[model samples]
Target chain A: MENKTENNKMTDEERLELAAKLDKELDEFINSLPKKKYEDGWPEDRWEEEMEKHPFFMTKTPEPGAELHPLYEGLQKLKYDPEENEPEDLATSYKEDGNFNFKYKNYRLAILSYTEGIKAKCGNPDIEATLYNNRSAAHYFLGDYRSSLKDCEFALKMKPTHEKALSRAAQCCYECKKFDLAVEYCDKVLDIQKTHKSIIDLRRKCIQSLKLKERNDRKKNQEEKKKMSEEETFFEEILRCGVTIEGGLGGLSLEKLEPCFPQLAAHRVHFDENKHLVWPVVFLYPEYKIMDYIQEFNETQTFEEQLLQVFECSPEWDREKKYSPDSLNIYFENPKKKLGTVKLCDTLGMVLALKDYVVKGGTPSFILLVRNSPAENRFLENY
Target chain B: MDWKPRHEERSGTLPQPSQETVKNLKELLKFLQLGARLDLKALALESLLAMTGSEDGIKSVLCVEEILVSLVGLLEDNSEPIAKDSAACLINLSADIHGPTYLLNLSKNYCPPLQSSPDTIVKECLKHIFNKESNIADECCMILSNLSRDEHSVGLMFDLLKETQYGFDDIINIFTKVDYNTRGAKLNYLGPWLSNMTQDQRVREYILDPEKCVIQRLLPYTEYKESIVRRGGIIGTLRNCCFEVLSNQWLLSEEVDILPRLLLPLAGNEEFDDEDNDKLPLELQYLPEDKMREPDPDIRKMLIEAITQLCTEKQNRKYIRDKNAYVILRELHTWEKDAAVLTACENLVDILIRTEDEIGCDNLKEVDIPEDIAEKFQKLDV
Candidate 1:
């Protein structure tokens, strides 16, 4: 026989179980040995402690054939030898053992017995299907719906019209939250048995869940359509405002299309409740990276009005308090990639009307600088 | 002495401390503690950093537990220079193969015993790591990345991570949020650090737990763009977690739906027929002509390896086959320049193309892989 350590790969769970077993074995081995003393260091004996450096002194070494441990020689033993019994007889015996355990509520033991019966390769399809069907019940009782469903599939593969497997499979799908699949499985079982009470109740529960899900999904879909229509209106308004959106080429990369907040990113520009055109705008503070995002910047507000309200309190990162409404300058990158300054006093509509200004991804971003400070000059030199 | 070739070839040993420096290290200990002069603390930490720069110096420093304790205390200093240098020293110490045990078990053996502290060194590292304004946050992350690299220390480091307020969930949250650090600290190194932590079986259990909803959060980052270190680290973490061969079926199923995330990176601009496209996951469905394959060959190899691990079960192998994963691997095989990655691709393809009758097994895991061969397969690096 090959060494246990050779040609063997264990699962993570198996390895952990082995580790615990090894730890226990080692602890028992150590405890059985007599203690030996040794010095740790320094004054060395201010307080005493015992150290057992080696177990060899007190433990008995197993000589070839004459000790408590023999390190068993010969074939590694199997718990049950399949070669000794005929497949059908062995399988029937295992099934009887499984049923006895299942009757007594020893589900785990019943599963093991059923698994062994399945592995017996009994050749008889009825016995094989029964083995898988019973194992599926054991797994379901253990709250392992997925494994139960898997076994049910295996049973149905061998015996297509197995009523118990089909019903259990439907129940497993329901537990797994696959409402549509559960409904399909339920129909399959109904095709076999026209009216089963428990199956009928399960079908009703599943239909209710599907109905609730559909209602929620339809409500969500309606909100999305309404948002899309509003976004279409905002596109028309952009043309009315005469703002150029560079279409097709050299436009915003697809990255800008993924709207994070307020759901559909395409609707960054939309009409406000008051019939005013509202736009999402980004205020970039190049120095501190503390950006101010206004998701509903209406066309009536001037650059001065917004900056005044945002910077009224000296922002915490701006310790020297350089940025103020009057000193702030707004710059936008034109199509030719030149930084053109807009007057802070100019209304949001006038800035949108500027010949060189173009909106990308429905969001117009502007850089803010405290006009004549070093931070402003540094930000200007980059463009 | 025997003139041994193996020993001679292995001879790039680190610089040891001079006897005088080792003897006088106590003087530096005073400055390295919590309440020392700022400049003096900086100077002492700098000296300790120099000591940690070598394996021998680290060992000598380890002998003095009080100095190690001082280094832990100094990691919280208000001065960036001192705190950063203190973190640098810990990174060096933690990187040493022998250092994790000492760091974890510090003050346990001290003669005077130890004064109680509110936090362990790990707790302090995590506090600074989570605090955005802290300059040494990334440096503290580097210590964990360095510590967990050793097999012996992975468990110790995970234990330390458990003690901190920032858990694996919090750690993953901060890592995935691009540009989360406003102080210009990338914290991308957390990727590999996470990979290292997964060596512990418990960490894998926590991440793979279906109820935690943790593994799904990491799936999208298989394509994270900013830093390759982060990308590679995440891929490595995924590969390591896939070692739970028993969990492979659940991982590949809709519960986790990991196959597409693994395949998307390997697929390129190559076109597939409508029939083929219908079989593929939605993420891999039509070709975008500009689409690029994962650039790093090592990560490509890891992604492929993760798939191979998933392939061990019959259910997952069927999922991989049904999802048209072979088409992506076929395209990858043609374009792959790395020999290591191509071999891995070929191995995965070998399993996929065969009929159950030809393979003769219900589950490939039942076909045992020899321990020796499994070791060689794992060591294949692209």
Candidate 2:
């Protein structure tokens, strides 16, 4: 019984080993079968080459039945044959290219394509309008609002009631801050579709923006007017009390002088042409006329001697006295003479005595002299 | 004659309040509670805003249980002044260390997340931001900016940015209308918010949408003169954008022409010994001969960083090589005295030179050929 059991166990082990060997051989046989091929047995590079030669690709000509294919149809539409095709077809093809570029957000390239289409001179108004309207969108995307507005205008001229063109025109106008034009375009669009919510909302925005801009402009104008009036008042005040020294003395007239000094209205001041001096002048306190010292004053030594002589003849002359120039008061009738007290004294020594008397710190005194006055006593009293 | 009151006869100063007359927290809270008149509520809100001006006042105010929740509730008041004052008080309250977290919690509990259609309070704040009245708008912008500091709040802001009807564009429009100096201040906070929001890939994609064109909108602000901090913020946001590879390609695209825009702010005045001045970018060619150059070193460093990031792409590297960017960068690198700026310039020069070597160009010497002539030579080499 033990021998029989051992023999049976050995047979069981041999049966298991035979099954394992048989399964390995079956796997090897399956692995040896040929692998399924890709792209109909063609390698990747060769497949690409074969696809390029296919009738549906971007080529000059397509297969006859391939016209039904979308890509083939697109390529066929864009293939411009100068001899067989009309310029309108060429223009339309370029317009389609522009639309493709626009969809891809290549605004500059789309603009170029649209421009090329426009140059093709397609006579179809609808096609031309579509092209111009599409170009406006590209321009608007590029922030060239003015150019966009112009293209919209061109589109409108071709097709006055084109809804897309009008709506796009409104957007371009709004971007350019031409709110009135935007409103006008929106009105046109609303006329076509009264219940259009987007257009209605846009029109409302345009109106509100227009009102705000007008208010700002009106405020600016009022401020500008106020500034202009203030400047005018300043000039009027200067004319009333002061004279400009810019033109020299020759350009002076009584009409111009009357506003500054009403006293000069009655005086007949004459201009000496060669000497460039005012005539009919008097030097009352000095007891000498300006003509007497005019020639001598031009010479330095004679001018100094004449100044000393005039000082010695003063009413309260004192040779030993010291005076301060601050105490000396000199007055001229015409403040517009462009001359200081020292310059006037240097030119005419009639006021030289008063300069010395005052410089010595004497009691303050006035030396008033008039030009072209017939009065014998021209100097006003000190009081 | 009638006898005058003793307080009236005294000096112009007001008499000190008696203990009974002094305003307490309970009375202020009662004034803010429902059923109060609009004027009384506004007065209470104003007082709270003034009180929160001090750190101690903020601490004392935050201690009240429902006071902050009431303020957030009042943010939707129909009366503009009441809403404005409430927003202002909230802004002040947000200054404390725990202030933002507390307010953010209140917002989360009371207000809907910004991704879902905004709640009444969020809408009210946005309305005030775009309102014709600048003061109210300023307060709203400040409140929103403060709230944006928290990570959850930033996520909410990103959601708000996604809502097309009233989104980032509206925020940018309000920013554009703000006075330049104030806009700069507002940008200080908004810039960081923008940088944080852009970390999400979806947010970056949303910003780069052609309809939005956020990068183009920000480019012009870099040249703004009202505030360098504002310009710095804009540059910082742009730097954050460069972290994404796709954005770098878009920035260097022909439609964007970002190279000139990036370089113009860094171009020093003619006083510098830039021998390559003739190679200045096309956008800068029309600037008046005597115009002053950018004096800030921080702005220059930001510009260099933008350029360095842009050079990561081969297409961008070729464009920079064609534009003669190397000459300008070399000149700036040599002439720069600031240590940080010099380092940035050095990094840019290294990238530009390394890129040229990678493209098989061996000798890297200074070439002074005319731009048009150089174009011809480049075509031949290609």
Using lDDT, give the best candidate's number: 1
Tell me how far the alpha carbon of residue A152 in candidate 2 is from the true structure, in angstroms, after superposition.
6.7
lDDT of 2 by residue, A257-335 (tens): 2212222234322224433223122222332332211112221222234445444544343233322222233343333
Q: B24-62 in candidate 2: lDDT tens per residue? A: 754676666444687888788888888889876776676
- Of candidate 1 chain A, the 10-residue stretch with the lowest lDDT total is A69-78
The C-alpha RMSD in Å for every predicted model, in order, reads: 34.9, 29.4
In candidate 2, position B55 carries an lDDT of 74
Q: What share of the true interface contacts does each candidate keep?
A: 0.00, 0.00
lDDT of 2 at B333: 70
